[model samples]
Target chain A: MKLKELAHSRTGDKGNISNVSLIVYHLEDYERLRQAVTAERVKNHFKDIVKGEVIRYELPKMGAMNFVMQEALGGGVTRSLSLDRHGKSLSSYLLEMEISLES
Target chain B: MKAIRIGGGAGYAGDRIEPALDLMEKGNLDYIIFECLAERTIALAQKEKQKNPSKGYNPLLEYRMEKVLPLCVSKGCKVITNMGAANPVGAARAVKEMALKMGLQNLKIAAVTGDDVFLNIEQYLDSTIMETGKPLRERYPDIISANAYIGAEGIARALKEGAHIIITGRASDPSLTVAPLIHEFGWEWTDYERLGQATAAGHLLECGAQVTGGYFAEPGYKDVPELWNAGFPISEFSENGDFTVSKLDEAGGLISKATVKEQLLYEIHDPENYLTPDVVADFSQATVEEISANNIIIKGISGKQKSSYYKTSVGYQDGYIVEAEISYGGSGCMNRARLAEEIVRKRIAYTDLSYEELQTDFIGTSSLYGEQTSTNLIPEVRLRVAARCEERKEAMAIGQEVEALYTNGPAGGGGVRVHVEEVISIASILIPEANVRVDVVFEEL
Candidate 1:
């Protein structure tokens, strides 16, 4: 199943740093999210574009995780030639990640 | 005690005004705030001010004031904004003039100035840019605006001085909302916990309708109730830093846990170290409680003392940018857009004109996500070629060459359009907070 089935994400960009927050629909799904959406997985998933380190911060109480990607955005919003300078659609793109359930 | 209601009237400079006006008219708001100014806008406004002394404020100030101020005055709802842009004093005078024209009596407007540090850019000449690490002197020749993000004290002082409308320059976006909390609850400026809580509340409301549903909706999985008339966000804040975020009754938007959580993390780099001039807010320990439909209570937000340094957004002229686009349609149009993009690149290369940055992407396809996302070809796509060049001639060629694509081949091209804009790039730097002094002056009709 895609991560979109369990969570929604939001992306924001400042300078070259891109931050994406992944929030699950249910508290029961947080452990699975924590295990699936690891920083290494996210970094490897977007390895071609993300040239810097990927750091994830957990908000277990809120059932959300924030991934901060440094040196992304191709030199930030103002300098980046990308059409979507603000990275508004990155969350939707990240939602395409495949999650395997150990049932 | 009942909490005071404050509404976010405007988010960006050109944000929709009708929803905010609706909030003011029917929501029974004690105050309304507009967080309109950003980093590069101040630089652009500085250029405008240089041309005409009274033209430095946000361009939409007149229209917004005309639509909301009269009713806000009649309803006894005070207004606050950073629409002052490059000139808070000028903006205040303009607001006062508008009130007088509207025949509103005793409308007190205060402009909080002293954010502009253009003359003192010389002192920070050797200071390095926080992001690029380039020395401030490297951008000095082209530097246009240098303003420090101030705290809420100036706004609180204005309210203390009986200001009905408070205008400020380069204040933190959250400061617009947090200032009202300070004035209403009489909280000490040093109260980090309370200030942090209010700052969090402000951040939640600063983007107007975003927290309500405007930016939270998806067609199926995560849906919002009413999007067309998405209601701007309002907060009922109490003295103890407890608040309920709601909107006007029967407004078209959903205020659920999901929406609030999305907004909570909006632009937040770190939940524990959200820095502002007033305080370093920590939202990790905060809890969001949905009291009812469209009424979400947020509490337990805390923060540490503010740092001694103030963050400054230094805007400089980064040359010019040109974007030109032409679409391809009908069968195999995707191939045509790509072919057109290739032609554009060859033309730019043939001209022997170098650019600071150049990119040619096929729109209606994978423009930003690159080829990684868009694996299939579409029926129609637009070829967009853009360049950042130091010289106007080079920038002009970026579009001119694209226009020539119509005659140069890649058939079925239409809707050819080109745009050339002067670029203003911003750099962040930290300066001694003590040097940035905020003073308020009153302008009354």
Candidate 2:
């Protein structure tokens, strides 16, 4: 299963920093996410776009996780020359992450 | 027993005004705050104000006020807004005149100023750009607008003065709601923990309908009903700083823990220390619970402390941005799109149209996930070319080159759209909080 099967994501940008929040549909799936979605994997996934470090923060209360990508946007919404300056589609990219279902 | 219901009106400068009107009509609210100013919006507004002294406020100020003022006055709901982008006094005056014209004779409007540092530009003569750490004098010839993000003290003072509508210039977006929470709850400025909770509520509600499932709908997977008529958010802030987020009755949209959680982390840098003009909010410990259908309770928020300096947003003339798109389809669309891309690049290769940065991407094929994502060729694709230049005509020429691909090249190219926009970029720096002073003046009609 893909992350999209159990979660939905949203992207927000400020300057060159971009934060993508992943919210799971079921609380039972959070442990699966905690085991699968590691910060190193996220940093490796966005290594092409983001120039700086990727930090992941856990929110067990809301069953959500925030991945902060530094230097993710080309420059940002204001300074980036890319078509998707705000990187709004980046959330969809995070949702593309594949997750193994619990047997 | 001290509780106030406030609605988030306009999130951005050009967000839907009808939702705000609907919020006022049906939300049973005591106050509605419209957070309309973005980082670069004030610079653009300053350009307008330089052109016309009486203008430079929000573009939809009259239309929004004309639609909501009558209802707000009747309900006695206090209105707080940062629609006074470059000119608070002018916005207040505009609102006052509109109220009188609408036969609302007893409206009391207040304007908060002292955010702009144009009058004291010399103080930053030796200052450095916060992002790049470069000297300010070396970058650009002009600084369009240098305004600091202020706190909620002036707004609380305005409410104490009995102003029904408070218009502000360059105030922090969250402070618009935080101010009202302070005034109504009699919370002190030094109450960091309580202020953080209120700031969290303000942050949750500042983006209008964003926290109420408007931006959370994804159709099949994350489904939401009646998204077309999605209602804006309204928060009931208690004296203890706990709040319930909900919308108007019979309005569309969902307000569950999922929506609130997505919003809680929006654009936030550090969850342990979220900085604002008012407080250093820590939402890490905050608890969210769904108490009813389309209503969630948010509580347990805390704060560290606020910094002694305020963040100043400075706008400058970066350059001009030009974008042109040409779509190709039918038989050999991807090939034609590639040909179109090459043609645009070659045509503008040797011209005087010097661009600082240029980018190209195929919309249907390689826009987001890169070229590796699409193994099979698509039937259709959009070839988009964007360039940043120092001159308007040069930027326009970049578009003209792409538009020429219809007759000059590309067999199946159709639907050519081009845009040339002024790029007013922004930078930030911090200054002493004590250096900036805020004053609230009222006007009655």
Candidate 3:
């Protein structure tokens, strides 16, 4: 299954960093999300785009996780030559991350 | 327990004004905030100021003020905005002039200045730029604009002085919403908890429609109704700091727990350390509950003492970027697009166009993901070539090379478009709070 089945995400950018927040649809799925979507996994998922380190912050109360990717947005929005300067569509790309369903 | 109703007017510099006008007309707002300045917008505005002294503010200030000023005056609603960009005084002056022309009286317009730190750039020459980890002196000559992200103190002071409209340059986006809360409730600068809560409310409202269903829609997954005419957000805050997010009943959009939650963490890195000039707001334990349709209560947001230094955005001339696109269609369109990309790259190298970096992308297949994208032959594809160069002429050559593909190469190529724009990149640095002094100048009409 894909992470989109249990979660939705939103992407925001600041300078060369892009932060994507993944929120679970239900609180019950939060634990599973926390286990599956690690910072290492996120870093690997965006290895091509993000050149720097990825730091993940947990919002357990809100059943969400925030991933901050440095050296993203192709060196920031104002200077980047990328088509999507802000990398706003990164949330959708993150949603495509495959998640193994709990048996 | 008096609750003050505040409406988010414009989210960014070019946001729609209709929703804001709707708030003033029907939402019964005590204050309306327009958070218009983005990270690099003020820097670009500075370039404009250099060319013309009188014009550095948001270009839409007159058009927006002309429409909302009368409504605000008649309804006794105060206005706050960072639409001043590089020049708050000029923006305030423009608003005062427009208000007088519109025959609106008893309006006290305040221009909050002192955010611009270019005059005292020498003092920060030794400071390290957070982005590049380099000394400020390294990029001193290339620096175009340097403005410190000021707190709500100046805005609160303006409100205290009975300013009907406040214009500011480079104030933190959330501070636009937080200022009125401080003024209304008389919250002290040292009150970290209340400041934190207010900052959360401001953050949620800062994006306007983002918390009201504009960016929350997903066709089959998370459906939002009437998103086309999605309304901007309005929050009612009690003196104690708890607030409820909602929109006009007749307005289009959703204000569910989901929308609010998504926006709560939007652009935020750590929920616990969401830094603003006013406070270091903690949203980790914040709770969102749907009290009713289009009404959600946000609570449990706390704050800590703010940092001693103010985060400053330094804008410099990065160079020029030229982007050119051409579409191809047919059975082998993907191959044709790749061929065009190769042709452009070879042509640029052959012509010796001096560029720092260059990239070629097939729009439909791999423009966004690059090499990671799966290659599948598609019926149509758009070939896009973009290059960054120090000189404008070098940037123009890349675009010209792409445009030449219409008649020079690729079968069935059509709809070629090219754009060459000067890049104004931003860097972050910190300045001591004491070094930056904020002053509010008032103009009464």
Provide the clashing-pair count of each candidate structure. Answer: 0, 0, 0
Tell me the spans in candidate 3 whose CA falls farther than 4 Å from its real position: none
lDDT of each: 0.87, 0.86, 0.90
In terms of TM-score, the best-performing candidate is: 3
DockQ for every prediction shown: 0.68, 0.64, 0.83
User: TM-scores, in order shown?
Assistant: 0.97, 0.96, 0.98
Q: What lDDT score is found at residue B109 in candidate 3?
A: 97
What DockQ does model 2 achieve?
Answer: 0.64
How much is the lDDT of residue B312 in candidate 3?
A: 96
Sorting all predicted structures by lDDT, with the top scorer first, yields: 3, 1, 2
Q: What C-alpha RMSD separates each model from the true structure?
A: 1.4, 1.7, 1.1
TM-score-superior candidate, 1 or 3: 3
Model 2: per-residue Cα lDDT at residue B148 = 92
**What is the C-alpha lDDT profile of model 1 across B1-445, one tens digit per residue?**
8588999888788999999999889988999999998667888888899999998999999999999888777889999999999999999999888888888898889999888887888898888888777888888788888999998989999999999999998999999988988898888888999999999989988988889987889999878887898899998998777988998877898888889999999888889999999999998877788998889998879989999998888888888888889988998888778778877787778888889889877887778677777755577788888888998888887899888888886888998899888888888888898788789989987
Q: Count backbone clashes in candidate 3.
A: 0
Q: What are the runs in model 1 whose C-alpha is more than 4 Å off?
A: none
lDDT of 1 by residue, A1-103 (tens): 9999999988977778889999999989999889989999999877767888999998888999999998778777776777887778888888999999883
lDDT of 1 at B311: 88
